[model samples]
Target: MVTADRRQGRRRADPPPRRRRLPESPPPPPRSARTWTWTWGTLLVVAALAVLLLGRTDVLPLVAQRGAAVVLTTLYGVALAVRTGGRPVISGALCLVLGVAGVALAEPILLSGLVVLTGVVSAVLGVMLTLPAATFPGVVREVLVAVVVAAAGALAIEGYAAEVSRERLAYVVLALSLAGALLLVFRLGAGLHGLGRRGSVILAAGLGAVTVTLAYTEALRRWASPGLLGAFESFVAQVDATLGGVPQPLAILLGFPALAWGVSMRARRRQGWWVCAFGVAATGPLAVALASVGLVTAGFSLLYSLLAGLVVGYGVIRLDQFLTGPRGRRARQLEAASAHRPEPRRTAPVL
Candidate 1:
């Protein structure tokens, strides 16, 4: 039956249908991504601190320390390769095998000798595996130059070692080898040309300082008084205390930010910059650890710090890219879509 109003061409008003209620979803289960990130980050930091503390305690057996060193070196090499866009898993396995072999071969020699041998071998392998294919010829030539220089330097060091007190020979050899390697890299590789005149001068000054400090320390060790040595030790202790008793090896972490920033500035290209950054990060810690242990002289610490600064600088740039890159754009798109979506409307019931 139709209403009289409808017969007269006037429609009856109908009540609006009740709005349907949506079931409330459980609050997004506590963002596991953030949780996992923080958990892993905390664990890694703790592990690093523990390792540094243990190393400084001088309680670990020498063999254990050497093994730890080999493992760390191999890991660093793999990380450097991966960060530079090379094959990571294969590089990691190769690094592990080569590092172990080098360490095993060096075992007949003293710990210091083993350190030098393993370091050199690891460095060579890292360069070979990580460098771009196009640079192979240049790298090969550089390798030849490096080998000749290293051989000559080794002979000189042997002569120097024979003449010096046994205590001083290791330190002297290590310092000279490091300086020589740096010089060869700068002279033969493209690094120096890229650095410009001012950078070159700075590098030269740093090298000079390292050499002078090594010589001065060797001389002092031969003639300095017990009182003077004690005073120096006390000063070092004070500095350590001021730094909250952080082991010197771990001090490298503090300089990461600065290193990444500097590297980004020097290497404008993304791929090149990342490679440079990882290289610096990996090597800088090794340098710092060596210097802290007196295996490398104090002057060389400046160079190591600079390397770390470069690594961290590049890291900063990478972080910026992540925040503004493709992923970031996608996230913005999702936000826009959600914001513009229309709400559901209620419909009137028909009579």
Candidate 2:
């Protein structure tokens, strides 16, 4: 090759660098399918078992009579523990120690603590999947599914073996719990938060706490007040007479959650005052009774229904916001007002 010579008095430029474009990456598949895979799989399995074994007396009475609940509980506990993958919370060492203590004690409190722990762990796992690859997100969902199934299965077994002086009340409580829980779970995937979740949760918690409180009070030999006692008698009469097919005190129970939800959504002043009024209305003269199926219990039933309505309404509004980006009401109103005004006309001078 000849040696290169430098240019003199002549401008020289370097050759332009070639630009190469990289191929664009394809968009990822939608995650709905993945989440559905686990949720559906779980629903299918549970549904199949329920359907197949539903009519069979063999499966019906077996668990209760045989203490199958304990087994189910153990299985559930283990499954959650596995799901957690022993992720540390607070402290790893502390978790291990407490977990071991809980195990060694086997007391009800300890066991209950463990159950709550597992739930917390499962939730954490779900939150964890919200980031990064979102890889195997369904795995965490499956684990939660497993937890609910196991807990319900075990509880059912326990309930069946449970001895209640009055089978009617026992069945009623169980039925209500089952119905409410079922409702909660059915809409679980719908992701109720703004109103749906908060409402439902409030309803569940408020009603649940009140019912438990009443039961405990009664257990402790507490007697109802004169008016309350009269209502109780009326409740007894209606139930015994078969006058109506209404759940007792359901409205009052329902009112708590609904009212709580309204307070959550609106300011403490505007909505809270009204909500408080209605709540007191439920608790006060039992005015909500008029809405109930039963003569005496309708007032409380109405109260609860009102609360549920509020919650559902609030939730719907919030969900709308989430789905369709938030917009100001004042801005929309102003735009509407402007639209009605005459359009501006341009004036041209003589050319």
Candidate 3:
């Protein structure tokens, strides 16, 4: 009777799940290297089609016609949704549509639209996923701060470019470097919090060594490059002459701290550190190109990536320890075994 009642309740609750039309069955899963081979091949095809579609159209004005970018991103979101169970695909689709819309409007409405959309989208997605997207109350403030720093970087880059008479390019770069580093460091703090004392110390030392060495290597590259700093310097000089305000935007964009900051803060250990390092390394070239229009951008790109990588690597390892702990897993197993065995009671000594 109970089983019958329960079945009836389930029937009432779901209403039979109605026979839904399903997507077509895919081919059997490929093994080993075939997996990557297939995935990459599919991606290339999709990408080619998307490019052909977006490229031939003169949709929005040039800068925003970055629809090809949007398509790639949207498709990638769909792909991630497949791998990560759909969170990113959903979130990214929302971001793409909204971002494109914001970019489409005329001025007085355009930039404002972009800013509002950016904040709203971030807040909404963060809530949907339980990520700390800075609460709605403080999100605007944070966005504003990010904007200020990015704008400052852009203005400074512009100043450097156009040969504005100022002894302050060094100061501007210094400020941005400090701000970006601090952004990364604060991000690392999350990882550190996850790591307790012992794990934290060991991982810190390891990450520190790695970050320092990487930074040094990048510094060496800057010194060794054929054009030296001059090649870099002149690149900015040319940008200034051509487009005045581009550098600051590029700098702000560059200073956005590697995405690995999230993973680095999550793991506080081996896997986390690796994820953070890999993400930053993967993005290094792009970041460099995005930060400046010329040579200096390349040098700083390598420099910032190395620094961020090292910082996140060190921090993630530390946190991983705290979250998983050294003895927690083993202790649980031992306890489980003990629970199954009868306790050996001891007699008290005759008193």
**Each model's TM-score?**
0.38, 0.31, 0.32
> Model 2: per-residue lDDT, tens digit, 1-351?
133444422325666679898998998446676356446644643553453234234455543322232332333333333333332233434444555565455455554444333333322222111111111222223223322342243232322232223323322333333333333323322333433544455445654755675576465445657787778678767864573334334323443333343333232112222222122212211211221123244434433444454445346434533554336866544433342222111111000
- Clash counts for all predictions: 13, 13, 12
Worst 10 residues of 2 by lDDT: 342-351
lDDT of 3 by residue, 15-78 (tens): 5556879998998444656467447735753563444334335443444333443443344334
**Best candidate according to TM-score:** 1
Please identify model 2 stretches exceeding 4 Å from their true place. Answer: 1-37, 44-59, 64-159, 164-221, 224-234, 237-245, 248-256, 259-351
Cα TM-score of candidate 3: 0.32
Q: What does the lDDT read for residue 342 in candidate 2?
A: 21
TM-score of 1: 0.38
Give the poorly placed runs of model 3, Cα more than 4 Å off: 1-64, 79-89, 106-194, 198-271, 274-291, 294-351
lDDT per residue (tens digit) for residues 1-351 in model 1: 467668555433555679999999887435576366446633543453344345545775444444555555445445434333455568667756755664566533344543454344333323222222112233233223322222222221221111223444444434543443454344323564566654455455544544565578767767899999899889867865564332322224422332233233222322222222223222323332332333223324434543444344445545644654336657644533343222111110000
RMSD of 2: 17.0
For this target, which candidate reaches the highest lDDT against the unseen true structure? 1
Against the reference, the lDDT scores of all candidates come to 0.40, 0.35, 0.36
